[model samples]
Target: MFIRKLWAYLLGYLILVIKGEHPERLINLAYTRGVHLWDLCWIDAGTLTAKVYASSFRTLRHIAKKAGCRLRIRRKRGLPFLLFRLRRRRMLLVGAVVFCLILYCLSSFIWTVEVSGTRRISQQKVKELAAEAGLRPGSIRFQVQRDEVVDHLLRELPEIAYAEVNVGPRSRIRISEKQLPEPGVGYCHIVAEKEGVIESVLTLAGQPLVREGDVVRKGQVLISGEISPAPPGQDEQQGEQLPPRQEPRFVQARGIVHARVWYRFYGEAALEEIQERLTGRKTLIFRIKVPGKEVIVYGPREVPYQFCRLRTHRYKLQRWRNISLPVEFVTIEAEEVRHQHVRRSYEEAVEMAAERARERADRGLPREAVTVRRRYKVLGGDEDPVRVVLTVETRESIGVIRKFRPENQTDKTGGKEGV
Candidate 1:
């Protein structure tokens, strides 16, 4: 069917209306005379419609006349007729050709630049670096060197460990930042990070300063990094000769001090609250956006509802390989909404407040901490909203490295050194 239509279009075709007493006879006569006719239908008792190839229309007209029917051409279609029409409007033909050339020229240049996989390093910074390497917007997509852009990023930004550049309709620059280790201190002590009751201590390379069941405050040393040698033994003392005083050695402290820590979290919820909900009514607006301006193509310009939510979707006109048109189709959907006051019972409000408090407390808890106990309490008077205070106790390692330097001179009087 498509091939037959293409053949008809290449040779041109005409739609004719036949009006007479014996229009049916015309169809028979045309078929008997070897003239092709298609889409035959009766418009009325005296009128009929049919499509015939332009080359065979003259023969069909003769057949119609002999069958006592008058033929009238209704419409003309096909490429031949289109070319004839364009021949009369030469400027339209020229404009079409110019549009094609402009489209082809615009497709060669880049329109958008995108950066992904960046953290700590700003996307704008990466884009600027890429622009310096000649891979920015308006640059030729095929001519921009991806390797140069990658190299420029890696060199200009020391934090970037890896970079990849892809040039197409939109230029994309992907980068991975180098993970740097934290600076270290040579001589350090393990100190309590928070006030807690010590449960146990495990020393890896430090002097124990706190014992089990002892209460330690924040910043208090849990382990000492300075080590002083033991005094001479009883046998050496009896020999009447004592070894010289030994100097304290400074070392990096490493230990784990598990302690019980407490966290207090508070939350409240009102028995009455206002919430917004959708009303199920929506309006859709379609628009076309060009480089400099946007035009509404369909739907109303102003939203009908005063309180509403808006969602927008945008689509580019056309894209092929590294080429994309500047035109975009935008659809905006506005949904009507209404706010209503909702009332909850006292028990429900208390539960809600308690859940919020629990969540807040859990967020503050460390991943390695083991939960020991939890307690919840209600606070405030009846006039106040339901309030909840949550107290959580957990056992966790409280030791943290604290750097310090020991005094160069040791006191002969055997006085303890200050940390």
Candidate 2:
């Protein structure tokens, strides 16, 4: 059956009815001439129908006329006939080719950008920088280079430690940026932030004021910027006069001052609490959106649930490599929800409050600091607001840059120059 149909379509064929005297004679002539025919049937004494290739149809003409029979085409089919019809509408064919060309052209250009992993940097700023590097929306996808764009971002923004520009489908570009940490305060002295004994000292730059095992108080200068260098390899004769008087040089102090610090946090929570949440009842509506118009072809016309939260997700139709289409498919879901009351036992509330307090205390911890000790205390009963207090003892750098003027240093030798 497949072979017969294929043969008919390949050369184009016609279904014909023959009428005249001795139509049987025409059939015999077709067989003798090797004209392919199938499904030959005699409907009445004067009429008969059969299938023949379009090329064989003309071959039967002379045979039918000689046999005193007339052949009439009941239906025409196949590629040849279709092409013949299409040839008449020249403009339609041209329009179809033009439409395809336009689609391809539009798809080659970028349309939108998605930025991720940015905190201080704004979306517009990122886009502007990307635009300068030829990665902006509306730029040609094939023309825009991702590596070059990344290089441009790193060069333009000193804060950016890492950057990535990824081109994806639907004419969209995704940007990822990691910012470098800002430098510490410049030109300042490191001072003691709390009263504690100096366990050990590591001076990167500056003069050491307090030595190891020395007890220092709050606001005390742990590392001083003023220094008087001893004469190189020179023997000091106390009985002899000094060669000359040396002046102390003032500079910015820098170093880590490890001191014992205390962190305290307080937290309270009520035994009874109310929260609004979804009730698991929801309705989903599917739709198609084009420009400013939306048409729902499936699902409910209106939301089926009351006191519900509605979430709509829309996906625009797109083609090869980020070529977005104007049409979009949207799924809207309505979830029913209500206010819920939660009652916690005294033990439960205390644990919750304690965790919150602990988190708060830990929040203020400095990087690389060792937690030497930790303690927790509960102050209120479950009937009252459960209050939990957390305290932590840490050993970390309490030193921060405190800038000072060189002129403020007192003259140790009563000289006019300040140390």
Candidate 3:
């Protein structure tokens, strides 16, 4: 079927070339034969001219003989036959050349990675494993063992739970991590560290021996892990005034304690405060790998945005974090957000200042303390350096030291049992 189609196309090209070079005789023959010929065009390197069709190449030959025009025919070069009636066929010939050029251009670079999602696992390490698995840049995507490659990569890093390897115009490997087991050694009970009215309490690790509504003073135990005195035995006697024959052993328990602490904060913030503005903002992105050079995913360019003030927070690699390569980069994106008015009333401003002062007091005061009252005075005006005065009161238990030693603590072992 292919060969027949090839021959048919060649015959059409030959007939077209013959009629293109001679038109007068072909026209005359067509008039006499009372037969029709379809419209045909003659194309060459520099010209695209139309021609009157002819029934046969022989009829076209007879006309060309009278005109003294040379008849030249040749098989076209390149696959899919480039047959030409004339000696030259350069215009159509360039198609094959252009197709080859496009093929070359597409093969020169890596287009994209097919798989992603390597969080705890490194992308570069996966790529390296892919390279070892025979999947890398310039490698034909179809020839690689994708599943086998993924299995191999996972085997190299036991830390990876599951891996998926994909091969497309580019190759990519995605990895998931297995959760690490928690370290379970031992724990201590956290008691009411500084006693007060039990405004609120939480049991993070051990049991709670006190409730929110209960009242407890300094040095008062809130939670107890130590076992209560054993029930009196047959020979044992127990009473408020009676003493035991044997000494009791001392036990220790440890834990955390938090209370409903209160505080008062004071500051004056004006409605017409001056702040820096940004005209254009810039953001960037980059990637780096161990044993590999840092790569910029998107390169840098001139930022069109303006910035009046800027603040930044940063995170450093923790001791347990095992990042091998140090990849550092910064990004900026252009934005038009600018500083504008954020207005409030004088009473509102004083209220905000008073609330801030309260927060500060809460952080510094004992947890048992509860906010009770707040007092404030407008110290100044908006035009004249504005000032605000504030006072906060809270209810809480105060500490009282009942015993002291040479070290400020006397062991109570000498006290009579049950006394």
Which pairs in model 2 have colliding backbones? 169-322, 170-322, 170-323, 171-322, 171-323
CA error at residue 296 for candidate 1, angstroms: 3.6
User: Local distance difference test, per candidate?
Assistant: 0.84, 0.76, 0.50
For candidate 2, what is the TM-score? Answer: 0.40
Candidate 3: how large is its RMSD? 22.1
> lDDT of candidate 3?
0.50
Task: State which candidate, 1 or 2, has the greater TM-score.
Answer: 1
lDDT of 3 by residue, 179-237 (tens): 32222312222344354455544333334566776766556655443324445445345
Steric overlap count per candidate: 0, 5, 34
C-alpha RMSD values across all candidates: 20.0, 20.0, 22.1
CA shift at 135, candidate 3, in angstroms? 71
Cα deviation of 194 in candidate 3 (Å)? 11
TM-score of each: 0.45, 0.40, 0.28
173: Cα error in model 2, Å: 40
lDDT of 1 by residue, 61-129 (tens): 778779998989999999999999999999999999999999888888999999998878899988888
